[model samples]
Target: MNLTISVVLLAGIALAVVLRLKSATLTGAVIALLFGFYLADTDAAPTVNELVTAIADAVRGIGN
Candidate 1:
């Protein structure tokens, strides 16, 4: 559950970056989010989840 929240927070940050850069519109962000939702339902979701977990672990290890 924590990892899921982390992923969502990171994705929101990404959208904010895009907005700042003027490279993405609100519609584009909505479409991207929908795409992510669809992708998460696919078989690739596990791989993505594992990758996020690994990244989170590495960041945590860096602090310790």
Candidate 2:
């Protein structure tokens, strides 16, 4: 139930919908999956995670 995860999932769904509307859903999804797998094994993953966490924290703070 983490806010960051929720936001990410929602964003992903939105992206998927957009891709589908453009008739590129399957191709885009496959490419994205491959890219994600590649990124996950990189040394920069921690930095990416931290950046995403910071963004989520900032967004949360906006509503307070």
Evaluate all candidate structures by whole-model CA lDDT and list the values in order.
0.74, 0.69
Best TM-score among the predictions, by candidate number: 2
Estimate, for each residue in 1-64, the C-alpha lDDT of model 1 and write its tens digit: 3544445555656667776777767776784686587668768789999999999999999988
RMSD, each candidate, Å? 11.6, 13.1
Sliding window of 10 residues with minimal summed lDDT for model 1 = 1-10
Q: Which parts of model 2 are misplaced by more than 4 Å?
A: 1-23
Give a tens-digit lDDT track for model 2, residues 4-55.
5443454456566656678566766765675566666768689999999999
lDDT value, residue 52 of candidate 1: 98
TM-score of each: 0.60, 0.62
